[model samples]
Target: MASHIVQNPSAGCIVKFMQGNEPQIAWVMEEQKGKLRLFLPNRRETTLSPSRILPWAGPSYPATQSKDAVVELLNRHRERRERLASEVAPMELWEMAQGEMERAPAEWFAELGYTSPDADAVAACGRALLQCKTHFRFQPPEFEIYDAATVESRRQAEEAARVREAMVCGGADWFRRLWEARIGRHPAPDASTAPEEPVRGRLEKMLRARMRDPETVEDEALWKQVTKGLPDDPHLALLLAMTWGLVPEHYNFWLDRADYESGTAWEEPLESETQELIRAVEEGGSLPPAEDTVFISIDSATTRDIDDAFCIASAADGGWDVEVALACPAWFWNFDSALGKAVFHRATSIYLPEGNCHMMPEALGEGAFSLFEGQARPALVVGAHVAPDGTLGEGSFRFSTIKVAKNLNYPDCEAALDGVENAASPFVESLRLAAAMSDRRLASRVEHGAVIIERPEIDFELEGEGADITVKLRPYPAAPRAQLLVAELMVVANAVLAEWAVKNDVPLLFRTQDVAVPREYAGVWKSAPDIARVVRILVAASLDVVPRPHAGMGLSAYSPVTSPLRRFTDLVNEAQLLSVLTRGSVRWSREELSDMLMHLSIRLEAAGQVQRFRPRYWKYLYIQQQARAHGDECCWKAEVAEENDMWVSVSLPEVQLGLRGKRSLFGEKVFPGQELHVRLGKVNPLRNEAVILDVREC
Candidate 1:
């Protein structure tokens, strides 16, 4: 290193010094043995070695000047320094912008040593400032520009700051005024005369802002300050509950979150298409003749998409001949049409607590293609021969038109089977045959090591709408005689179809679960914990183009060919089957099936999440409501389903409520299958959380 000694240096002299490799200008302030204290162009003071100093070559100024002239020169120099500082590095421009000095006028460039007539130099400096603005937040007025993202960020920050200020100084009224000002409106001079609409609008905006940027409004004190005096309003209270992270009064948010579009009049099948299809069916245009069989459908009373119906009769070879007729939506559905594509994206109908979203257009699903009583509809019929020993024999499928004799619901069928008053008049013989078939199928399934989980299903019905909503929970009646009949016959039909497809080497979607389940599992479970344990061990079923055994259903091969009106996969399968029957081969190849499944999986997963979560939300809401009605200290009888070191999962059988409780309350001895009485508390449906306040052995 060279000796850093400055000799004979005076104050107020412009000098150049080496800072790293580049030379920087400074004014000498004081001197020491080997170093000098100097002031940089930007007026920042620093100490440097004298060896780095050199006399400035271009300019010189006397140590003393007249006061007025000196002042003028200093101002000019300061302006030059500021411009230089801004140009020196990108960080300096950022600092200037952050300090609220975003622009510099053309006159400032002239003051910074550029002549007024040097248009190119002035333009160059402006260009430089414009380039810096790209990297910083500042811009010269001459080269001003705006970016949408940057503008949005600035607006959000400013709005957040304003909200904070309003919250700190004024309560709800002041914030409402500020919001009105932002939207270019003036508040009423008298508070009594203020329009309710504007107040509600302001409340909604604030709630949305709080939800969108929670970090800004996370302070509890600030929330209390801003929300003061607004809770009394019913609408504001509801919004506040949502903003405070509680479940909203209704489940409408799910529709928005899931992007579910409701059925509209315009969404119905085109009038021309409907009329043409109806005329075609009437004239028997390119369709198979009607079948001579008494067909009946079993479903919920509210069901509109009655897709599958069946009839059982004695065969010629001393066995049962079972005929199943599936509504033929595929005959009219155009696979390349926009409606078909929409149905593919939806994948399946969504059944909610309040209503359902159909997979097919209403006009077609419930009217044109529906297998209603006395209506002649086109269908795909599958005929299976059942041996006396409950073994399925030869099966064949065909396309035909069918007339359903009646559409019976499960309850009505059950009542008919039990020989109740008016119900016994219809479908009594069909119910008897269905019961015998179900019993045989159940025995077969049990012999094949299929585990039947008999957990009681709960039906949650919402009466009324919005804030006046009330949820009714009741047992859905698991495996009712009528339900069992429909389920067993549908399974047999699907299995026969799956086997036929595989034997013929046709590409079709097959539901598979190749995992090995316990071979001894059988029968309706008496304990919830036992059923839960068995369920935990079973692998989830998946769908593919290849045939594989479904261990849960106790089938060697299975595919869901029923419910074409409710599921797109079924519709696709129905279409393939129709093509095979009419054109002598399936329409889709393995690659095409795989491609369809790739998109189907994403949509199906999303729909499944909505189905799984939204129902639980409503169920928990019902539980909370019950607790509130009966008082928090009310106890419920629960059976322990599972337990760990810290928590115990309990099943409330009566209410069909499954929840967990801290193990500390019941002690370490708690185990599955143990019955206990527990009090419910801290029930929050929005968060899906609840705790057992107290517990004891029942």
Candidate 2:
């Protein structure tokens, strides 16, 4: 039949077909039904179906000819078709074909350009259309002219693909160079030699974004493609960022990992709110009358955000009249505003050996809202009477403008209280009275089954920058006297406020430790091993809306309302207390407070992790340096806290670090309260790992 004859190509007919994207010219050697055996121009033979061949097939030759003759014929035709294809412009043909017809065979397109076209001309037109996929799309027997919109979109996609290829080719070597420079393997590349414009910017942006959030990076595929040859480093993104100068050396990856923004840049959005609060402070803010009493604030020498201060005097009934003035940002804080939400998101200030990240903007936390000395600032004052026997009476809460008379540091205050030479100050009498009150309270707390463990206070400092960073630990001065006085007074104030909240039927967050403790575990513990033994039986304090006994503090309930500038929960509690005192009702309902606490608790837990890990990282670094300098002679005093068949948990009281080792490492006779000298082994700060190499009884 005629249809059967058309279904197969005869032998020696030159056919054009696509192997992949490239068009190949081949000679038909033999035919069986719809299948054709073809010989290509490169002397290769293949079996293909008629459907695989392009519609433009031409000029027949005799199959009985030798292989050399067939190859010569195929090459000659291919050269002619290529020359013709170069002469044809796909866009010109597309412009002429569009709106005239939806699609047509290659002969139709070729004839439009040439009035009398041959098979070679049609085949050339087909080849040109195949290469220009943007304007023309081939579908079997015809070329489809794309619409203007689709053509433009395809043009952009093609350009993007070309640029992406260039970036990957150029950026890989560039990044590896930077990483090499960061490790001091070689000098960094100059700016002139870096990848040009959009490529450089694109790479830097992707690297920084990946460093900040690796888990949710959208360009993970591209990242993998570009960083194919780099080392498999978990902190590779961070290291590359550091090398690229996108971040500094020793950058706190934890902040980025936690999605916490670390600088004052986040404060920009709250400028207007900060200015309003400053104006309020400068113009004597809208609040009740100023309190006449002058309060004294004590903090570390570098502290700037002073949130709590107190003044003591003799009461009418011969008891001590203690007035605690807490920084009152809650008075003007609008929890629904942008500024409020930002503070809530920050949750708490992070104090590291390097620096502090304040929860509130410094303009408010360290300026207008801070309890700076001699400045008239708004405050929530807690007035209560402390009896001679360290008993707290009913408390009175009020919001009023107040001024701090003095600001003192712990070292000077300690020396003053100890009557050391050249440390005399104006508040000697007040200091003595405060110390007496703290002594009485400590005794009372011990009598009430409190578990008090006093461990060493250690401070860490960074000496140099970058790779030469040296961490040094020192004993914290003034912890024995001045720090104790401030700690006790703040506790008294918080307990008083919490008790008042319970009596007034207001919903407030209280820190409760409701577990029972043995009476023998009540006294103060000072030794490293003794403190370790006592700490095992004490329950951790927790926050809740309902009041409950705090076994650790020996109080019925405790609420932290002092450091509003540093802690979000303190600000919240102050808001609750200030609301009832000023507006005569609670600002948040019980359900709302509960829901808020749930989110705040999660944030607090994350913040606690940062605080907990950062110091230990430095401590491990310090230990590693020591071991390298001293070898096996490097020893640290650790007190065993608990032991079982499988493990022995120990505490390094000097560094405030807890560690555990395998039972085999400690031998068979290990017990709690045993102090030992240990040599650390194989410390890797990045992995957060350190092993006890050897141990001996101290």
Candidate whose lDDT is highest: 2
Local error of candidate 1 at residue 193 (angstroms): 16
TM-score between model 1 and native: 0.70
Q: Give a tens-digit lDDT track for model 2, residues 1-698.
A: 00111224579788888977988999899986778999987888999888888887777766798999998998898999899999999999889878888888788888878777776788888899999998888898778888889899999998778768867888888887887886789987775777887788888888778776777567787788888878877778888877777777777877866666777999998999889988988888485589779789889889999999999887666558888899999988999899999899889999999888999999899999888888989998988888888888888888889889989888888888878653337887888888887888878887887788887778998999876788889878834777777888888889998898888778888889998898888888876566767777777787898899999888998989888899998999999987887778889987888899998888888777778777778888888878888888988999888888988888877677778888898988888878898878988775577888889887
Mind sharing the TM-score for model 2?
0.87
Give the alpha-carbon lDDT of every model: 0.69, 0.83
lDDT of 1 by residue, 1-698 (tens): 01222234555554455566444556666666778777665557788776555422113356564445444554564456445545544334334443354344433433354334132233334334434434333322232333446646766776667656644554456445534442347632343333354334454555554443444444656656765644333234334434333434563444444555655543664556655666766676656778778999989888898999999976666557798899888877777776777778778888887778777667777777889988888898988987656677656988888899998888878888888855435678767887887778777877776777776778878887665777789888543888888988898888898888888888889989887877656555658788778878788888888899888878888878888888888889999988988898779998999998998877777777677777877877887878878895678889999988888899989777688877899887887888889988887665567788999777
lDDT of 2 at 500: 86
User: Can you list the residue pairs that collide in candidate 2?
Assistant: none
What CA RMSD would candidate 1 show?
A: 10.2
The parts of candidate 1 lying over 4 Å away from their true place are 1-248, 252-260, 263-286, 315-319, 477-479, 643-647, 667-672
For model 1, state the Cα shift of residue 588 in Å.
1.0
